[model samples]
Target: MLLGRHPCWRQNPAFPAIKASTFRLRRLPSSNPSLRFAAGDREPRSFAAEEMGKPKQYWLLKTEPGEWSWDDQVASDGGVAEWDGVKNKQAQKNLKSMRLRDLCLFYHSGAKARRVVGVVEVARQWYEEGDGGHGGGGDGAVDVRVVGEMRRHVELAELKGDGALKGFALLRQPRLSVVPVAADVWERICELGGGYEGDGGDADDGDGEG
Candidate 1:
């Protein structure tokens, strides 16, 4: 579903307003001396303009395993599906904001717990569904493709228990379906996600997997 670029997005006016949450990172007491980011000089990776403004962007998607499983998304072509069934006004607005080619994280919510298990790409823009289509009161949705599963799951318990992520939105607003992850937060997650490992001489080998 593609929404023509909103005039407000260009002017950067705040239309859909939301409250802010605080997050902080702290080192965990671990014997694994190879985790170098623990010293705290690492910064999160920021999306370059070339990386942004594309038809797609990165997002975190949450769903209960009983309703939709990671395998369900993988079963679809390119893992694309019209993301619908949203009732929350804020969540709907976030869906409307997504662009094509955006990347998304597969988060399993509910009793199984919140964990980023995989990655997905936006294949379509905001489009209206139901009989009314784009012009009427129909709800909004987007097509997403599952790109790859996270090599390891970043569990909510692990995140909340981590000192560094003390201020993470996942900790503050557990109910928010769509939230922004700061550059720092992104890096920290990637690190915890196991993006960095195997530096040859590095001790401990970093064999943890999700």
Candidate 2:
């Protein structure tokens, strides 16, 4: 489903409001081994040339349902929200590697409902969050838009027992909030989530109250 730009975003009160000056937008260094970022020094470059028509990369994003649920994302202005406040170094790197149009599975990590509830498309790339100049560490953030809500929730227990998903980072590194999803794995999870059929279908905006 095509998502439009929306100006309203509801921030989690737990996270302090970040000032625009605190972060600077810069392109990822080309020397980095991963060819994740779009080439050239221009702002907001398209991936058509850099991707060479390869399947888009996929990711899994975890959030506590009570804190920031799928409904919250859909309700956000233009379905856009900043994926910020990540403190882990590895998770921060994953955020940096994200490119526009990358798909993300929105997983609810709440104790009561640990499941994949919706999908999101990366709308913006990486920007660094400063450490308040106190020497405290900061991390990267991205902007994502709600793509669709899963018809059926894919629970954690189901994935853990499925041999096909054994190697998924969500199962291996349960503590990590952000993780990469292989193309095959992404398809499989979508299948389990009630035949999502990729980007062609409309996203269900119903309350994903799992």
Candidate 3:
């Protein structure tokens, strides 16, 4: 959740110890033509849904409540914000893999009441930050739009206690800011969050926070 320096980055050997200035700049295609990948230093990773033979994927994005709360994201322009300042290499890779319209759970970590507070959609794909140069420092930035808030927040305690969520990445890799969510897990979490109302002529139920 801490933008500038992540404590996990220091402890995780998987992350490379490279300076921000060393990253090279390259332009990559984006759903939004105006937005392009800021740094082309790394090998190109395809985020096309067809290439992966998958439908819309789900993700979980963790942020400290104090630094960037659900309300803060909802208040941003068009209920969207540039999810930037990610320093961890794995997290950066996750950002690169995101495709437009991908739904994400907005989890509030490091809060007195840590929980999944809301949902967001990827509005734009990867792009550079600020001046969009090699020295700009923001190598990973994804535009996310707030889809809706959770009708009832799902606590981490509940997730850990649920047997169905035993293999969830959040529990295995607590420090990872961005994590992929399995389709079934996504549906289960949505139900737990009071967002999913089962099919049974209950679609009119005010379950979704939006």
Candidate 4:
């Protein structure tokens, strides 16, 4: 099936619009800083899980900002977009396991920015997105919406320094794009981030990017 256009968005321009150009889905962006998400607003992951009687899950998603930055995600279509492009077998397995309300940490991979900058939730469960005209099978994908951002970005160095996170999946499986996050570890990271896990939800905290 042809997937929606995934915006190959950027940040140096500051909140550029994300409109799907091809089978890859892109998101819509807003330049307004006043735009706020009330949790109840937009796509709620729990609604689907609640109706289907499925439990929530946690995970971490890593992406190189050169393709799309945190600002691109936040600005993308009211914080919602399809998280496509997983070709790795291991990572695709992780994506398939995601259920509604499954929370994920948005990790900015690559040398310049290696940190957890925000949190997103599964808006749509895993679905087969046939090659969008690409010769490859195109693997699979899922829809994710911005739930919130880390007011205080969590650095990879900090995560490595903390003895408590020794067994973190991201640490053990650095190459995996979709790594699961344990509940306790999730709390630990949030606590370490000054106890403000949902920074994007608060209008006063627009410092997630940078």
Candidate 2, residues 1-210, lDDT tens digits: the string is 111222322334455555566666688787886665455445665667777667689999988877778888888889998888777888888888998899999999977989998899999898776543111344657889988888789999988888888789998899998899999999899888874535665558465787
Best by lDDT: 3
| Alpha-carbon TM-score of each model against the true structure | 0.60, 0.67, 0.67, 0.66
Question: Per-residue lDDT tens digits of candidate 3, residues 85-154?
Answer: 7778998899899989899999999949579988899999988666442113466698898888887899
Candidate 1 per-residue lDDT, tens place, 1-210, comes to 122245554466554432233223577767675765644545565646435645334566777877777888778666666666666687777778876666677788998567887777777878876743211233767778777777678998888877887787667877877655655676677678764222123465598888
- Between prediction 3 and prediction 4, the one with superior lDDT is 3
Question: What's the TM for model 1?
Answer: 0.60
TM-score, predicted candidate 2 vs. hidden true structure: 0.67
Top model number, TM-score: 2
Taking all chains together, the TM-score of candidate 4 against the true structure is 0.66
Question: Candidate 4's residue-wise lDDT over 34-75, tens digit each?
Answer: 665666356657654565755567899988898767788888
lDDT of 4 at 21: 65
